[model samples]
Target chain A: MTLTEKVLARASGKAHVQPGDNVWVNVDVLMTHDVCGPGTIGVFKREFGQHAKVWDQSKVVIIPDHYIFTADSMSNRNVDILRSFVHEQKLPYFYDVIDDPTGEWKFDASKGQLERQYGSNYTGVCHTTLPWKGHTRPGEILFGTDSHTCMAGAFNQFATGIGNTDAGFILGTGKLLIKVPETMRFFLEGALPLGVMAKDVILHVIGEIGFDGATYRAMQWEGPGVYSLSMDDRMTIANMAIEAGGKNGIFPCDQKTLDYVNERVAENGTKSEFEPVEIDAAQVFSYDKVFDLSKLEPTVACHPDPGNRKLAKELEHIHLDRAYIGSCTGGKTSDFLAFAEVVRGKTVKIDTVGVPATTKVVRELKEILWGGQSVWQILQSAGVQLTENASCAACLGGPVDTFGRLNKPMKCISATNRNFPGRMGNKESEVFLASPYTVAASALTGRITDPRTFMS
Target chain B: MAHTVTSPVYVVRDNIDTDQIIPAQYLTLVPTIAEEYVKLGSYALIGLPDALYPKRFISEGDISTPYKIVIAGRNFGCGSSREHAPIALGAAGVEAVVADGFARIFFRNCVATGEVYPYDSPVRLCDVLHTGDVATLDFDVDTLTVGGTVYSLKPLGEVRPVIDAGGIFNFARQSGMIAGEAPSH
Candidate 1:
């Protein structure tokens, strides 16, 4: 049995379980964001009734991240709906944009300016913030309404996305019927080459597997290569599990996971009783398949499909109209650090955007100095358009007029996941998915240049 | 209890994600009212190539076409876990989807919403079924008959009741899992 099977078996209250066995497992946490939360609330009301209480208030988390900073009335209304629902239900875990305790910035509707408030409250991207807030833990079976929710699996938890209907049902029942998925383990051995991050490794994996290769199966990552990755890198790999049609992508809990969680807890000045779930030694075994990533090059998933990947060096002929580095997949602190390293003193030739994953990331960027300026300041000085705090900006391709939107038919090199047609904006526009290193390098060169060309 | 449908299947290739079913731009058009939602059903698979199938799922003047079944390749509904995808298909009068395989969330959404019945074809349905190919689906025996040959389908198993009850909520209501009058907002 693999670690995935062991986790499911325990969650389902069975001594052993096999693939295709349907089991009703108790859920520990449920998350919904602005884009999906309103729809989920509507479903909950329609099916469970308007006044029906959620199964467990404390266990439910709502974050209004996507479409929050947009001027669109519908997007704002979505956040309003979530706010009202959160208030009406008195949900304990609603993280609003205004909830940022830093109080450094506030969106002033009247002046259309981000003003300083004494004490503001806001949580950025839910995936980045959830683990930071201790909403996700090992051994827990969590469900979210966004496809990227599988990202929490980096904590060794069984987390995946479900539709609004299932979310409503889980809200009412606190249980979801799931078929135990066959696990497909990828044993990534050997250290990644310089200028190659987890994003490159995952892009390589997705390209090899195609978009649907791992459909309906648990994608588990293991081996020494996994240990070489940072927590942020691990999150980046797990975040795009859905890109390969995987049910979930997970990494077994390790010291890195523990250290990251502990540091986050300490930084937040909050106490958590959360303990990392222990792995059963008997469950460890040979993986389904293994890939040596030592020689892996910086890879990019070309236009139209994330599975259409090529070595970044091979794509230097492709010109970029825009370059973006942000999203759950590449908007972490480390991602920004990597981006800054590449574009340190270079001026971007094309439109470039850098959005931190959360408020904490922004704070972290302020600590790093590049060329006598903070990382964020240097990025802005280097002609990178940085957004306030964090949100799923153009990753989903917002309104035609939204910043970072693919308004025109042009090519863009992005660090975000998913390059499906019309994914970032205009259907005619093309998106190349790459790592922050590659994106920054491409942004400086206005072409798909490999990070190694500039890194050394 | 069983349901049967006979129609010319519209064949779509592999990995038909929710984004392709209906792009994010169209999601805001999905109204909360069921009636209004169905009105936008014509937009189902709107992003797909028009040259492939000349007739739209929902035709001009908001009239729906006659295609009731969609035969697809593997990993159908692989992307975003949006109920709107299934809802749009259901609204477009698509009664069932026959695919080589399905993404887990999309499969569960089909069962939970009871909007569309998803049948797993043992053989690649895309290769076996084609546009204007008359096919019959029998939910009772879990089989799809194309031309003169019949293909066995994966059984719904425990999910049958939920599908039979027209969704998980209905099943739960019937089984006494939810008791009491619908809450007034």
Candidate 2:
């Protein structure tokens, strides 16, 4: 059996399973955010009675990462509902936004104290924070309310998203009936060219396979190139699996996964006893199909469809009015490092926006120096509009009043996932999905230019 | 438990995501309120395609418009697991959807909510069915008649009961999966 089958079988307490076979699997974790959590709670109450409690409080994680900082009353009300639900249930894993109560700036650098006491309870971009906070583990079955919950599959887990009603049922039953998805393996065998990142590789794959090419299948990455990718890069690939109609995208666990999890756990001042999941050598040949990504180039998904990809060098004539470099798919630390490499010492010619995935990433950015100044300061000086709060702002093409919303029709090159119509803002606006390197390069050149031209 | 209907087929291309079905901007409406849902449903498929399709499911300046069936290409609902997509369509009077394929989550949502009958076509239904073409769908016989041709639809299998009971919650309650009077709320 494939890795996905093995994991699902183990979770379901079955010795074997096949594609299209439905089984009730035990859920290790269930996550929801402000946008869907309130609806899930409503469904839970309506179906299971008002006084019903979740099956397990510790296994549930709730975060209000979307629409938190917006002035929309409905968005704020959703967060309030989640807060009251957390209070009523006494849930331990709720990550709420922290506000400086005293509003005083007293710096004690020697004591490692900053001016404002921004509490550490918040978890920005739940997909990125899940692994940072030690919620994702190999061989586990995790579920979230967001489509990109498949991002957790980078840790070699079977993770996917469900609708509010299914989530409510899971909340009450602690289990889900899922059909085992067949695995489609992609053997990445060559080294990516300089300035080409995992985002480009995935976009190339999506281009080869249209949006519905891998419907109801698990996309498994393997071989030398897959092993060579950083966890951030792997997460970027897994996060956009749904864009290609994949059930999930997974990379088998290796030393890199273990090392990253260990470092994150240590940074949190905790000792983790989590062990890496072992795979059978004979199970490697069980993939239903395989694709090769040896000759891939820096690619970009053009307006309206993520599968409508072209080589970055082929689309240099397309001018960009805005460049955004942030999201669960592109807002990691390594993504920023790549962005800085291309944007260093260059002024942006277009409206650029940069947002770190998490608060921890923000703290790390403050300590890094770029051109004799903090990386954050350098980006700001380069005319990149950095939002203060970390949330899913404008990624979903929210209402007109949303921050970073496309007020007028303009072409944009974004590092985020999905380029569906009206995805980033105005319905007439065109969005090109690319890597941070490509986005940064395009921002400097005001067009979709390949990063290799700008790289040192 | 099953019924047949004939209506004019509204053709849409592939990958009609939930975001396009009902943008996240209108997701705040309470799901239990019919008027709120009807108001939110008015904007279904708004700003999606330029021409060759009806931009809005609910007619402008009028709340009631007859639209019973939608025929689409492959992967009819491919992004996001928002039930609001089906809710908006159902409220807009879309009774059934026929496509070459569907995203698993959306297909399940169709069965769980009983809001729309999701049928799979062997061939690209969008290619065979055209806008304003009268199509007949028989759930009992699992066949679709469009453009003077009869096509067999993939059987619903175990999903039929969920739709027959008018939703998953109703099926679960009636089947004794849960013990209690179904909560009215």
Candidate 3:
């Protein structure tokens, strides 16, 4: 049996579940957030005819990360919906916030108000919150209401996002249907060539497989690539598994994963050693699929869609007006480390936007890049616009705005997942999706260029 | 009721998104009827916000030659899940949108509101609706017709009857069943 079947079996207390089988499995974890949460709870209540025994309230995670600043009125209204739901459900585990109690930050109340309005507390963003806060463990299936919920697959678990209607259905029944998808193993071999990060590998795979190639299949990554890449990089790849029509994308538990989890939850006394799941050697696979790391280079998915991919070397002569790298997809520690290593001493050209995931990432990268741990000073000298605390702004267009078509169509190299038309800041501005390293290289050069030049 | 009509049809290119079908800017401004919504939103969809959108179906985009029906190419309705796409199409006075493909979710939603109908064969479609010809469909959310004529297509193979009964909520009541009491899955 495949690892997916085995994992499902282990979680469901069954030996195996078939393609056509319908098993009544209890939900292990239930997650909802922000705009959709209120309406979903409302619908769940209406559907069940009354408040029944919830499968487990403790497992319910409600994080509000979308409308962070309440900068726009629409976001404020959305926050109102979340507040109403949090109060109605009396939910407690809603993390993802920046509120500090002391007067050292008087505006903390304003930030707290934003959190109360949006339903986040002194925790953090949802995707980073669940795993970072030690809630997730191996050998479990988690269901969330966000499309990017598949990010949990990086922790070696099966996770998928359902629509609001499906979420309501699950919330009411504590059960959901699954057609135990067949598994597809991606055995990547060879040390990654210079400048090619995990993000590039996944983008190349998507380009080869098309956006929906792995539809209804669980993509399991087991190879030399898994060991070299960091957890954050693994997440960036797995998060977009849904876009490829994958049920989930996962990597097996390794020492790096165990150590990372152990350090964070060590004080919580949480054990990091999970009953690691192993693949059966007898299972007949596609025989074996191999990708040569030496042949692969940095890739860019030209805008209008994520599937419009091409090698960065192919677009070497192309010019760029923006370089963005911050979102749930590529916004993590190692993404910045790879980026700073590319742009540390080099000066960024004018009109470049280099944003990390959080203020924390910015501080780390600033120290790495500017040699002062304060990025603003080095960025001011480097002329790279830095927007801190505006998380997801590089990808989302509320604060750290990208290009507007009115002002000469801007061509950008972004680390965000989707590159759909009008997705960046402009309907006409061309956005190129690439790894963080590729984006950082473009920022320094003022155009779309390959990152292999800077790598050792 | 068994409905049948044969007509030639007009054709639309695929990859039309929901935002194009009905720009969010026009949802509140225009009248809610499918015809007016179509009149107001169709131009914006074809990337002609100033020209054909506010006016009636006149340009080549709205070819009125052989018939009034429309047959679209692949992956129709590819953007946001706003209910406005079907609303605008139905209100824009469009009779039907016969596509080789449709977004699974949007198609399901459209089937619920009785604004559009899905058909398989090109014979019955071409009989009453010619390629590039303007066609009209009188859709009942259960049955659709070309130029006020119903095309003869077999009963739905396997979409939930709920979508046909004006969406899940309405279908539940119309099936002589009460809410909070759906039959076992």
Error of 1 at A446 (Å): 2.2
Give candidate 1 regions above 4 Å deviation. Answer: A99-119, A266-271, A284-287, B29-32, B49-55, B60-65, B127-134, B143-155, B175-185
Candidate 2 lDDT by residue in tens digits, A1-456: 777888889899999888889999999899999878988898888888789999999889997777655556777677778878887887877777754322322222233211222356776788998888888887889899888999988898888988888898899999988889877887777677778899988898888778877788888887778888888889999998889888888888998998887777677643366544465675633344344455666799998788998999999999889999878998887888889888877899998988777777777777898667988877777888876566676787764555576778899999899877777767778899999999999999999999989875
Worst 10 residues of 2 chain A by lDDT: A100-109
Instruction: Write down the worst ten-residue block by lDDT for model 3 chain A.
Output: A100-109
Output the better candidate (2/3) by lDDT: 2
In model 3, the Cα lDDT at residue B158 comes to 46
Q: Can you give the TM-score per candidate against the true fold? A: 0.91, 0.93, 0.75
Q: How many residue pairs clash in each candidate?
A: 6, 0, 33
Q: Candidate 1 or 2, higher TM-score? A: 2
lDDT score at residue B55, model 1, on the 0-100 scale: 59
Best by TM-score: 2
User: lDDT scores for all predictions?
Assistant: 0.80, 0.80, 0.59
Q: Per-residue lDDT tens digits of candidate 1, residues A1-456?
A: 666677778878898888888888988899988767877888788876668899988889998776666556666667667778777888877777655322222234554323222124576788988888877777778899988999998988888999888888788889888888877788889988889999998999989888887778888888888888888888999998899888888898888888877777676654455545555555533236687878899999987778988999999999889999888889998999999888888899999988777877878888877666899888888899887647777787765544577877899999999887678877677899999999999999999999999866
Q: What is the two-chain DockQ of model 2?
A: 0.58
